[model samples]
Structure formats: structure tokens, C-alpha cells
Target: MSTATQVPELSVRVRDRLARRHPGALIGELTVLPGGHSGLTYSVTAGDHRYVVKAVPPGQRPVGRNDVLRQARVLGALAGAVEQVPVPGVVAVDETQPAWFAMDFAVGEAVEPVLDEPEVPAATARARMLEIASVLRRLHATDTRTPGLDAPEPLDAAGELERWSRTLHAVPPELRPGGEELLARLAADVPGGMPPVLLHGDFRLGNVLCDGERAVAVVDWEIWSVGDPRIDLGWFLLFADHRNFPQLGHAVPGLPSEAELLDAYLGDRPALPAMDWFRALGRMKMAAIMGHNLRRHREGKHHDPDQERLPPTIAAMIRTARDILG
Candidate 1:
């Protein structure tokens, strides 16, 4: 079903489910929050409380993406776990009937606009990048032995290559060849062992909410996993690199260069020796994901207008991956 038809039904379900947990509460002004390619997000008001409700679409069981319950569990696990980064508290969760959960609405704008602002000072932009690096360091440094936390399966270079290869094969036929070639190259040159750490699988400016220069919260945990910490670092670098997507990484003036950001992350540590390999792998992984979404859009399984631009974006990502690999 399209978003136009889905919102009302989602509103009714949210109201009913929330009312059960909070008697005498009334929901008001439920509006759709935009910008995400997966999952349905709504801003809802109940009595004096405001919340963000996220749900999987009706009749669609998204494999390996947008799992609302899994996100809730991670949010819950990180609630009081990290002192430096803010994670929203779980308000409620319902696994039945469309699979949705609610969390306190974070009160800040996404970090993207800040990075994109031309009038912002160069020093301010550099400081913001440093702050982001600091938060990521904190997240990677957190202990992952908490109870009830769903530990992600261990992943090495070959394993990650195999995982994305399956995703590539599942994409549209037109995109498969390039994906296969990238996977093969990555498999052949797979980097050796690096210590695994808890990863925020899709970390970037867009996933972070900032108040002024400080990151108040890091939202979206659907892809949280256990893997090489440098994967997150490489993904962040890829997002900022203009060679891959001009609209993303290099658009904002005053931002740190990829090397500078990596230096800040590395700090006193000797080196991130496998970073280049992970960077290329990050681009390939992103291309495979976009290709899968493009396939879904073609089959009418998902309906995001932005998916129209993904074909060229995926092509560009594949090209960049090849250049990096070479």
C-alpha cells in the first residue's frame, strides 16, 4: 500500500496501542516524518507527551532492513549505556499488527543541514567534525556484553564480501554484473583480521541529531552489528568523499578532509592500516543496497520517489568502488 493509504491506518493502530499503555491519553497531530528510504516514521502527540513512532509497512516483511523491533531493542540496550551520546528512551513497542515502536522524539535537527550551510564558519565546521569523531569513538569503545542485547554475528572480509554478494545477486539483472565483479575483486583481496567492535552500521551526519555543534542523539539503529570498527569509519569517509557522491561528502565547506577525519579518529593509535580496503567495501556495500531498493521500486514493492535517482547513483558508486579497488 502507498503512504497515502497507510498513514490513517497507522494512526489508528498507534492510538489504540498507546492508549492501552497510557489510559486517558489522547493522540493529536500525527504527521509523517520524511527523508528515510526505509520504514514509516510518524510524529505523534499523546496528551502532553510527544513521540516518534516507526513501523514496517503493511504486508511487507523487509529482509535485512528496517526491522523496527530490532531497532527498539538496540535503543533500549543503549539507553543508559553510553554517557557521551544520547539515545532516545523507549516509550513502547508492539510486535503484533504491522510491527511498530515508539521513542521520545529527539529535539534537534539532522547534522546534514549544518554541514551543508555555507555561512557557517570554517572553525565551527571543523569542530563539528571533531565532535562527530569523538562520539563515534565513544560508541565503538562501549562494552557490548549487556544482557538482552542481540549480538551481531561476527564478520570478516570474506564473510562481508559473501553477504553483500548475496544482496547483489538479488538486485535487478542490469546491476548484477558490476556487483558480482566488485564482490569478486573484494573477495580476492580481502583484508586480514582486525578486532571486532559494536558497529552503528549506517553512521553518518544524517543519522545524527545535533543541537548547535553538539550531537544530542544518534538515531536509527536497524543495522547495528558487530564488525570491524573501521567499517563505520570507512562509511563515514565515503559519505564525505566528493568523488563518490558530490551531493554528499565534499559539498560542505570547512569540513575536514577524509585523511584529517581519519587522523582525528586514530588519535594516538598507530594506524588504521586496512582502511582503504574497507572504504572500497563500504562503497560497494552501499551500491548493492541501493540496487536492491531499485529492484524493489521496479517490482512495486516499495514506493519512494527518491528511488528514481538510485539507478545512476548506484552506477556512480560502483564506478567509485572500482577506482578505489584499483
Candidate 2:
């Protein structure tokens, strides 16, 4: 059965668990939060308090440190470590079969839809971009040595290229050649190393929550790890770039250019010479991920109508990677 169809049952499970925790608290609404690719997320209301519960999709095996409990541990560590960029506090965790965890629901709308709104003023859009940049800067500045947070294995660009190369096989046959070409290019010209920092693995406008023009919280910690901070910066920059995915529509007006956002992220530090390489890698990585998701949809392993549009999107990203790498 598709994960979307399982939402009602999952909601019942969450409600029953929360009811036990708070005793007399009433469990109110429980609705799915759309747009996440990895986990099934639901917004649950218990009495007057709202919480977000994320559960592993049924019949899906965990891959690459994406465990719900690991996410909870990261969020718990960040609660005491970083104040500038808000992250939800853990409310409860269930690591058994069909693993799930709940955390306080964060306020504000996702920056994704906000950026697409034409009514949003130019100045307001610019402020939102800057706010996100500031939050990322603060996140990278925080020490990764915080207790309870496990130090991830050192990131190897070559190994990553190999891993994604295998994942590319799952893509539609039409896209496999381009995927292989991108992987070969990345493997051959892997950029030299830089110091690693705590990376919000899927950092982008879509992952941030904005209250008007102010960024209030950075959510979705399932992919959190220690890696080249530029990996995060590159992903955010590509997502903000209009040319990368024209299917997503025109770039938002007044949003900071990539150079400006990079400056904001770097602050007093010298500009990264390998930023372009990282950006190219980010495009390739995202393309491979989309390709994999499309495969799942085609195989009936997952269900989402939106996955229908991913082929052209993945193709566009592959073309972007080629241009950037050239």
C-alpha cells in the first residue's frame, strides 16, 4: 500500500500515544504535511499544543543514517547548542517497527510557497533570503562537538560519486546515460577538500520556515551530518537559481544573487574557490535523488502524483550540472 494511504492509521497511532502521555489532554486534529520526500509527516494537535510526527514509510528500509531516532537526537542536541536558528524540541519517540517521533510544531509557512507568491514585496523577499542566510551562517558557526551528537564518518567526494552512481541505475532508462556522464565527471574532477562542519543535508528554501520576511526555523533533520559546509551552501544556491529549473517558474524578484548569499554565509571568511564545483555536485546529487524517487513511484513502492513531473526536472538538473561542470 502507498504511504499516503497509511496516514489515517498512523494518525490514530499517534493520537493514542499522545493521549497516554498527557492523560486527560484531548487529541485534536492530525493532518499530513506535504512535500517531504523521505518521511511521512503529520501535524498533530494535543489539547492546545501542536506537534509534528514523522514516521518511516511502510516496507521501506532505512538508508544512509535517515533514522527517526537519529533525527530526534540531532534536534535535541541543537536545542541547547544553537539559538539563532530554531529547531523543534523532541516530544516523544518510538523506535520500534514503523518508527516515528514527535516534536513541537514550528510556526510559519515554508519559504517555498512564500517565494512563489507574486504579492510578496521585493524588499520582503530580499529580507527572507537574507534571514535564511543568517540562520545558515549561525548553524555552521555552532560547534559540531556538542554532546549526544555523533560525529559522522568523514565525507569522501569520490565515495559519494560512486554511491550515487549505483543509485542512478534505478532511474528511467532514458536518463541513465546523462546520470552516468555526470557521475563520471564528478569522479574525475572531484574538488579538493575543505574543513567539515555540521551540514543540514537537505538545506534549501523549501526546508526553512518563514514568518513574513523573517526565517523562524530550519526543519527536517533526517539528513543531518558532518560534511563540507559548501555542500549545504551549494544546494541552497542551486535551489534559489531560476535558470537551474525553469519548470519551477521564474526566480523570485529581489532575492539575493548567489554571490551575495555566499558572502552573507561566509561573512569575513575569504570566498571559497571551489564553490562552482560544489554547486555542480549538488545539482548532480539532486538529479540522482529525483531519479530514484521517480523509480519508486513507477514501481508502486511509493505514491505521489507530483512524482510524474520529475523526469523533466531531473533532465534539466542533469543539463545544469553539465553546464556548471564545463
Candidate 3:
């Protein structure tokens, strides 16, 4: 969370920019929102309406995922077009330095795989997971060549491996045991034939805003891109096993087994080949991510003690990837 003094000008600029969109509306305070990796997120009020503000951090160039307007393009393209799966509506945008965009604050809670809400019934939680699976299937079915996606070529399986490998290389080897071997295995047997689709990059129960058993909005487009659908599928499937996400713990009722979730996703579609490779790649990606974060934590650059528990999990993911490959 940003302190009042941190980005004091942010609120003023946001209010000024938003005012153009909703003339005569009285804009309220802008409150910093926590948890996004791309940039500073905030919730602001204007008249009777509330909106979310995703912006490039102060002084940083708005390139890659930090380009909030790029994300806004995605939101604009997908909003209200895909059935069942809804993303936030783009309300306004400012492409200036510290580029930002305001979107309708998606209404609902972001539920974890465990369905941590005590009031949500087990049946309801299970239903939500299946619904999310269906939503993912539909999302992938959408044309990858959608105008705003902007990528000339899709990121294939090997390219995906290389992308994460760059992150893995930054971490000390001990943190990610067998990570290189796992990457090599994934690369040697790159899957082919699956058509390119719009990938959420980190699609899962936790990323969606839900109302009861329904996923109202799929939030967090920070890492979204055009790629093989399995990249997202495998990532989402990793959550089915509690071990991959130890922070959520095990034995929380109501989530579907990974097989059931995949079945739901496939529905009438044929089974995707080389899924084992994709699954292994998913584990490797997670290991790399955790390992990098663990290194950061150890180096005192990012202070999060919870990352300490990640070494075993990272090792486990690499082992699992190797085992799956073998």
C-alpha cells in the first residue's frame, strides 16, 4: 500500500483526468490498492460511481506490462464480447508520463481455490471451479488475432520455456533444484498443433472476482498475451494440488480434482496432446517464480518472510516436472 506522501500527485492527476470523462461529477479520494505486480493500483470514487486506477509507477517508462493503456486495450477488446467471462470495463485513460487507465471496479470477492469464505458452501465452491473452467475454455476459443492483442506472432511452447528460463537464470541454483534439467526436458519435446489463443497467463480461482458460485470478472491482465491455451490451462491446474500453493494449505473443502477440472474445460472439445509437457512447464514456471522471489527476500530487496517456505515447494515442483517428463 502506498503512503499518503508516496504518490501525493497521483490522486490529483487521477481526479483531473477522470473529471473529463464524467463532467460535473464530484470525485472522491483515491485509495491505494495493494497486490498488483505491474504498477500502483487504486480505487477512486466519482459522484456515485467507483472505479479502479492502474498506472505505471512514477518515473518508470510505460513499456511492456506496465503500460496500463496496453492493458486497457485488452480490457476494451474483451469486455462484454466473450460470454460468461466478464472483464472490467474501460472508463477512461491517460497516456501521459505515469500512464494510467480507469476501469469499473469489478464487484465481488476474489476467492482462493480453498474457498476460504466460511459462508460459501462446498457445493457452491465446486460449482464455481467448474464454471471457471468453462469460462477459460470460452476465453481460449476467442480469436487470438483480436485487434487489440497487437502481437504479430504467438508465443509457442519453446518460447514460453525461454521466457521463464530468463527468470530462472537470475535465481541461485540451490533454490530451484533441477530447474535447468526440467527446462531442457520441456524444450526437447515441445508440443505442436494446438492453435494459438488468448492466454490469461495466470488464470485461476484467485484471479477472478466471484459472486457466489459465479465468476463475475476475470481481473489482473498484467501478464495476458497471445499464446498456446495450455500455458494458462496448466497454470490453473497447478492450483488443484495444494502442495503447489502451500500458503493456501490443504484439506479445505470443495475444489475439484485436476482431472475433473480438465474434463470441464475440454467439454465437447478433443483432448489436447502433450498436456503432460505443459503441466511440467507450469511447475517449472512456478518454481522459477518462487525461486526468484525467495532470492529477493533473502537479499533484503523484498521483505516477505512467507517466501522462506518456498524452497521445498520449488524443489517439489522441479521434481514433479522431472518425474512427469520421465
Highest-scoring model, TM-score: 3
Model 1 worst lDDT window (10 residues): 111-120
Q: What's the residue-level lDDT of 61 in candidate 1?
A: 90
**Residues 149-245, candidate 1, lDDT per residue (tens digit)?**
6575766677777888788878876864476677777878888867777788888877888777877889988778877787788788775644565
Q: Taking the tens digit of each residue's C-alpha lDDT, what string does model 2 give over 173-218? A: 6854477777777778887777777889788767877778877778
What is the lDDT of every predicted structure here?
A: 0.75, 0.75, 0.81
Q: What value does the lDDT take at residue 198 in candidate 1?
A: 71
Instruction: Name the runs in model 2 displaced over 4 angstroms.
Output: 1-24, 56-66, 94-99, 113-121, 169-173, 176-181, 294-312
Per-model tally of clashing residue pairs: 1, 0, 0
Stretches off by above 4 angstroms in model 1 are 1-26, 60-63, 95-97, 111-126, 169-182, 246-250, 292-316
Local accuracy of candidate 3 as per-residue lDDT tens digits, 254-275: 5798889999999987888888
Worst 10 residues of 3 by lDDT: 113-122
User: Each model's TM-score, in the order given?
Assistant: 0.80, 0.82, 0.91
How many clashing residue pairs, candidate 3? 0
Error of 2 at 101 (Å): 2.6
Could you tell me which residue pairs clash in candidate 3? Answer: none
True lDDT of residue 181, candidate 3: 81
Which structure is stronger by TM-score: 1 or 2?
Answer: 2
